[model samples]
Target: MTDRAFRNLDNLRASASTARVLNLLRVSHEHGRTDGWRAAPLFENSTLNRCLVIKHRLRRNEIDAFRVRRYVATKIILPIDGSDLRVGGRYIFVDQVGFDAMLEQALGIGPSHPDRKILALIDELPSLDPFLLREQLRRNGHAPDPCYFNVSEADLMRMSDFVASEITPLVDLSIGPDADLAAENPVARLTAKIMSNSAGEDMSALGQTLMLRPEEYEEGVFCWKGFLYYKWALQTITGDIGWVVDSVRRVKPRGRVDTEQHVAIDRAKEQVRRRILITCEATADMLRVYDDAFRGLTREGRPTAFRDFLRDAPILFARLGERLGAIQHIVSFWKYRMTGDRSAPGAEELLDLLADFETSLSGRERPDVLALAA
Candidate 1:
């Protein structure tokens, strides 16, 4: 974490760009994590404001060369598969005709169908909240894929261990005895194989054993993985929220703190602390839906409930992931700033940070607040 981390936080305009890029990055990475992305340009003022301004920086197939362009304010639902996250959408390529031709040739994007925008903000953040990632899928459209989403190698590194610790019990609870699986349905053997890779790799055989249709199996497996990631993420973020609550006030800002500014700061601190906890609790409460459904499947032997839970996961996951990501961006950003060796942001920047965090929750909105003398 360096001053560059919070460089955008000082100016109001840049701060908005910062927030937008961060949110887009989280949503993109969460839904489509396999590809490498670099945020070359954060904002632009081209005529094509509505579409994603995509350009290759250097070599054609170099995974790192994504640049920015300006376009009309097009709705980038994000690519479910790293190129297009949602259902079929439209893009109006309103930019340089010559370069547009080159991009069209390069990425197969025509003037009417130019590609790329989700990667513009990937570098500004470290990790994303699971809840927000899924929310983007729901809101944007169905992120159609074999696994419903993709996973990068970096993220999958620890997944094998997570599966090792949890999947055996899960299999026992959901499926019956091993003898039954071995004798009648050998495809159920994929249960053991699942622990080897958590990316839902080649699960069609497992899906067949579960009696899930092709589409159902794909969506179900993705939903299942999403929940797994959510569970993993929830544990870590719970600790993060705890840290934020405990240290929001304790983490010193760089500049002076006069009495009036102190009072405002206190108010802002209380609001952020209280809301952060409340938001985390709400996300936890939503997790109970999946919990109850799992209980029904394992304890009561009602696979229907679990199936229903999987089917309905996108909607619920979207809402839950979104709220979690918002708070997370705040807390994580704050933590990044505090842990840096350089001087902290001054009082005004601190005030803005608290104000942003205070309003970053579901169904909540607040105008920016001006800082008093410090």
Candidate 2:
């Protein structure tokens, strides 16, 4: 469907009560002064921050109806970049309910759960890109309603397009010239409903097209979609990533640092750069496994290799999302925090940012890359 029709369908989905804490930019400056909570524009970087950042004053320990918004560089679905930097969801970080009626109208915030684990799952990763979120839900085995996703057709098309261009040539050859199954299909409709709910009965259209069983359709096809996204993500950042690497080495902090601080910052910058290259190279290598598997399906008409690859791919997402999220975080946050007329932060802040980036890229051993993507 067209954007207009997709929006019409999006409008019909369920909504939650008036959201109070979400509209961080629009809240009255005076309304929360009595309490320690403060609401202000997330950034003075132009007028639009695309996200709402609320900070609080006393009792900082997590408690009482608050949320944590995971910062992201690019939202996979909406493809936000350049200026738009919408942060993620919330938690018990708040102590007051300033105005509950006025905050729910934002473009993305929606229904929430009470479980802290669930909330962490929502905010932990840098981006809640639906394709990965879908995988997260299935593996964790938490079943929420489809309205939980709150996705529009245009948003769903991002995954559809990625799969078409990168994953499923069978989708094109089996159908018509159109490889894109994203256009107003029942599968897309249900997937849009709950990105995690890709196991819809409507899998027939795609499954039959591929001549696969329901089991294969559920596991193999969905994993294919996720891998294709990771491939696109690696390429998109390949050109821009160097700027972040160089900036880390060259960008000077506004304040001087003691030897410990200076040495730590230097260590962090080098480590971040080195690991970023290693992780990215490792990621490209893993993607080649998918590429080879897909080749068997599309070229050799052999589904076994593809199906086997899907079973093994989930181990990779935790690594992919963490590493890519950090990379995307540094690049996008650097653009938001460092570029333009925004003044540079002190050396301490730089160290903190680099440390965080380094931590995210840690833990995964280099994959046994066949390097077919090379």
Go through the candidates in order and give the C-alpha RMSD of each one to the true structure. 12.7, 12.7
Candidate 1 C-alpha lDDT tens digits along 235-269 = 75677778778888675667788888888888888
Question: Whole-model lDDT, candidate 1?
Answer: 0.48
Q: Against the hidden reference, what TM-scores do the models get? A: 0.58, 0.59
lDDT tens digits by residue: candidate 2, 147-239: 322233343455565544553355444455554555655334443322443656644654665566777677665566566666766776787
lDDT of 1 at 307: 76
TM-score, predicted candidate 2 vs. hidden true structure: 0.59
lDDT score at residue 102, model 1, on the 0-100 scale: 49
User: Global lDDT of each model?
Assistant: 0.48, 0.50
Which portions of model 2 miss their true places by more than 4 Å?
Answer: 1-114, 123-126, 146-163, 171-212, 368-374
